[model samples]
Target: MTKTRRAARTAHTSARTHRVLLAAQLGNSVGDGAFYVTSALYFSRVVGLSAAQIGAGLAVAWGIGSIAGVPLGHLADRRGPRRSAVLLALATSVAVASFLLIRSFVPFLLAAAVYATAQSGLAAARQALLAGLVEPGARVGTLARLQATLNAGLAVGAALGGLALSSGTRTAYFAVFALDALGFLVCALLLRGLPALPGTPAVPGEGPRLVVLRDRPYAVLTLLNALLLLRLPLLSLVLPLWIVGRTAAPGWTASALFVLNTGAVMLFQVRAARSVTGLPEATRVVGRSGLLMLASCAVFALTAAGLGPWPTVAFLVLGAVLQVVAEMWHSAGSWQIGLALAPADRIGQYQGFYGTGVPVARTLGPLLVTTLLIGWGVAGWLVLGGIFLAAGLATGPAVRWAERARSRAAAPVAGEPVKAY
Candidate 1:
């Protein structure tokens, strides 16, 4: 075969793999959308759980799941990411299905914890699989495409879930859960088609099993990323509350903001990621994203200026646009740096550790952000914006420190002559 033809065939295979992954993502994401929309109602109406029970159960479940991720990810590294991912995906399906039978608070909490742990593990395993399959140069771009697909799937799933919400019937809620369960099942089946990857063996004399914990610089990066992830709750909790209580804008404006953010991410995330090709560039992009987030916060604060309904809506829209754009930029940069900095042999554990940031932000952000943005009002907005700005600005130094540490670790020991293979 000619060299060009071989290269073409390789490219075609890669494209096919990427498509499969996207399909799997869309499958589960649709289920996620339905669950997100209807789960609370399902628990309350169908299972007779109180609001406090639901809240406390989920918080504990996710918190425990977040801490479990690092160890589970390490297992993925030892067992092979593809196999780990497929098994965890199946586990996730089972856990989601278990919710159908759960009635009391204890059963609900156990099921939720199982579901959260499987989800965290599956995410790490899938990330490891992506790194193994795709070329280094294309990882971030491929991640961008995945993000877009995720949003698209979520939107479609949300619409379906909304139908279930409208019906408010037990059968309708059960259908949503079934669909979510089926989605994960499909995801596992699709993953089975990919080429197998062997697990990476630990290096001789490696100090510990979970090295990611001991890596101070990576921990700093993870912390900063978690801080930026405050944006998650800012959108889901803070903005919606702000629109209703503080601004003169109609309740519908909150929904509109969600649509705008989702649509923009689905359409523009890949484009936004185009420039973040390296660690240095990714760090710079994060810094810039922080600035955009800060600007959006300032704009959001202005909504309380007692502007009329239309004007307040306009301000809200503008702030949302800015915030979503920053979200795209930050996501792209974080993906690049997170994937790039980890040691190749331990990517799964590192990615899992890094991923805890999402749960951390999700678990804590609503309370913290609400206290600041809603409690103190405009000054709170300024403070929140400053937090983003500082986190962004701090990334560069953290990355540099990580890079230097990596270099030192890889350097040949003194008085040990470098040997050619």
Candidate 2:
């Protein structure tokens, strides 16, 4: 084939691949959004579980599930990401279906644990698959596009879930769960078409790969990333409580803030990620995200000053905007750095390790935000902002240290310096 023709063909194939992958992501995210909105309600009203039971069951289940990521990711690395992803998706579907039979706390906890483990496994495998599918340079941009698509799907699914909430019927809940399972099935089928790319084979004399855990710099990076993810609960849980108790804004303002955040993410996430093409740029983006988050916290704190209703609402909206902007940049920077720092052969394990931050943040963020940000009021906000600023400033140095660690690992014992592997 002519050079121009070959280039055109390759570009077309790449575009087609991206489209299919994005469609699968959108489908899965839509179901996840609906499930997220309705799961607690389903367990509470439909299953007739007490609030305390549901909370305890879910907490224990999630805690157990959080530990599954590393081993499952290692499994993906040892086998193949494509096959592992498909299996995990199927497992997730089964877990979601199991929710239909849940009655008492024991059954509920079991279903939740299964669901969480499958979800975590699926995430690790999917990320590994993406790494194998796309070129390194394009990974962040593709991830940003997928993130935007996910938000868009979630917005639509949240609306559907709201309809279910309004219906307040067991059938409505069942329908959402069923749809979630169907989405996972569809995602699995879509992934089935992807090419296989297994983990790198072990070297002759190399010991078993436990590198991710032993790498202190990477572990520190994961911890900081977890801290950055505190944005999740701050927006979802803390802000609404603050608005209702401390500010004059109406209850509906909380829904409006959510809509604003979702809309902003859908519209701006990809665009915001465009500049974060390299490690240095990604680190800078993370720092900038922290500054934005700090500004958001400050804006949020202003709403607590007994501002009038409309004024308080305006500030709340502004804070949501800033927070979502921070989210976009943080996500972009984190995706780039996480993928770039991981060894190609062990990307699955590293991704799984990095992903542990999500559960960590989800598990601990509520307590931290509720205790510090909400309990202490304005001082809490400043402290939280300071935390963001410090974490952001530290990201660049942390990344450099990780690079140096990699260099040291790659160096020969004969005092010969080697290029970073």
lDDT per residue (tens digit) for residues 155-225 in model 2: 88888898999999889999999999999999999888877786655554354465677767888888889
Model 2 scores a C-alpha lDDT of 0.86
Best by TM-score: 1
Give the distance in Å from residue 225's predicted Cα in candidate 2 to where it truly belongs. Answer: 0.4
Highest lDDT: give the candidate number.
1
Candidate 1 matches the true fold with a TM-score of: 0.97
Cα-based lDDT for every prediction = 0.92, 0.86
Candidate 2 off by > 4 Å: 411-421
- Candidate 1: residue pairs that collide: none
What's the lDDT for residue 408 in model 1?
Answer: 71
**Reference-based TM-score of each model:** 0.97, 0.95
Q: Model 1 off-target regions past 4 Å? A: 411-421
> lDDT tens string, model 1, 1-421?
9999999999998999999999999999999998999999999999999999998899999998899899989988998999999999999999999999998999999999999999999999999999999999999999999999999999999999999999999999999999999999999999989989999666555457788888889999999999999999987788889989998999988888999999999999999999988998999999998999999999999999998999999999999999999999999999999999887878899999999999989888888999999999999999999999999999999999998888777643444432211
Q: How much is the lDDT of residue 397 in candidate 2?
A: 95
